[model samples]
Target: MKIILNGKEKEVADSTTLQLLLQAMQLHPEMVACELNLNIIKRNKYGSTQLGEGDCVEILQMIGGG
Candidate 1:
């Protein structure tokens, strides 16, 4: 399956949930936000959210420096 991640095209397993994707990328869910195919996925639902083929994922990191 093919999906666009952070504006880059990549191949991923079908029915891949958001939680698994983050883990594979070494990304911590608590430190960033994810937009799944243009929809905002709540933190609580990350574990259940599934990513399908052609899905676009936009991950944004939260900055704390002042």
Candidate 2:
């Protein structure tokens, strides 16, 4: 399936969940915020949020500098 990830088109496996996608991308779930199709998805719901074709996903990671 094809989806828009961070404004870029990408292909992912069928029935992919947000959690799985993050893991595949090697991202730390605790450090990032995810938005699906313009809607913010709760961290706890990542495992249940299924991704579909044409879905728009935005992943923002937190960084700290002092």
Candidate 3:
């Protein structure tokens, strides 16, 4: 399946959950925020949230420096 990840096109497995995708990308959920298809997905829901083809996903990493 193809989806737009952070404005770039990418292919992912069918029926991929947000949690799985994050793991595949080696991303730590605790340090990032995810928005799926224009909606912000709650961290607790990552395990259950399924990503579909053509979905637009935005992953923003949290950075703390002051």
Candidate 4:
């Protein structure tokens, strides 16, 4: 399946969930914010949120600075 990740085209496995995607990319869910199809996805729902073909996904890394 193909999805638009951060404005770029990406090929992912079928039936890939947000959690799986993050793991595949070695990203920490707690350190990033995710949005799917223009809607923000909650952290608790990462395991349940499924990505579809052509879906727009945005992932932004969260940085803490004082």
Candidate 5:
């Protein structure tokens, strides 16, 4: 299946959960905020939140510095 990830078109497995996707991309769940289809997803729900085809996803990473 295809999904829009951070404004880019990307292919993912069927019934892929947000947590799995982040793991595949080598991203840490605690360091980034995930939005699916314009809705912000809670950290605890990542494992249960399944992504559908053509769904828009945005992953914003947090950077700390001063």
Candidate 6:
């Protein structure tokens, strides 16, 4: 299946959940914010949110500085 991640198209396995996608990308959900198809997904729902073909995801990380 193909999904749009961070504005780029990528192929991912079927039945991929937000949690699994984060793991595959080596990202920690606790340290970042995620938006699926322009809608924000709460951290508590990552495990239950299923990603599918044509879906779009935007992930942003929180950084502290200055």
Q: Which candidate is the best by lDDT?
A: 2
Expressed as tens digits, the lDDT of each residue in 19-45 for candidate 5 is: 999999999999999999989999999
Clashing pairs in 4: none
Clashes of 3: 0
List where candidate 4 sits over 4 angstroms from the true fold: 63-66
lDDT of 4 by residue, 1-66 (tens): 999999999999889999999999999999999999999999999999989999999999857788
lDDT of 2 by residue, 1-66 (tens): 999999999999999999999999999899899999999999999999999989999999867878
Q: List per-candidate RMSD values in Å.
A: 1.5, 1.5, 1.3, 1.7, 1.4, 1.4
Model 1, which residues run further than 4 Å from truth?
A: 64-66
TM-score (all chains, Cα) for each model:
0.90, 0.92, 0.92, 0.91, 0.92, 0.91
lDDT (CA) for every model shown? 0.93, 0.96, 0.95, 0.95, 0.96, 0.94
How much is the lDDT of residue 56 in candidate 4? Answer: 96
| Alpha-carbon shift of residue 13 in model 4 (angstroms) | 0.8
Off by over 4 Å in 2: 64-66
Model 6 poorest 10 in a row by lDDT: 57-66
How many collisions between residues are there in candidate 5?
A: 0
Off by over 4 Å in 3: 64-66
Q: Report the alpha-carbon TM-score of model 4 versus the true structure.
A: 0.91
Off by over 4 Å in 5: 64-66
Candidate 3 lDDT by residue in tens digits, 1-66: 999999999999999999999999999999899999999999999999999989999999857778
Q: Score candidate 1 by TM-score against the native.
A: 0.90
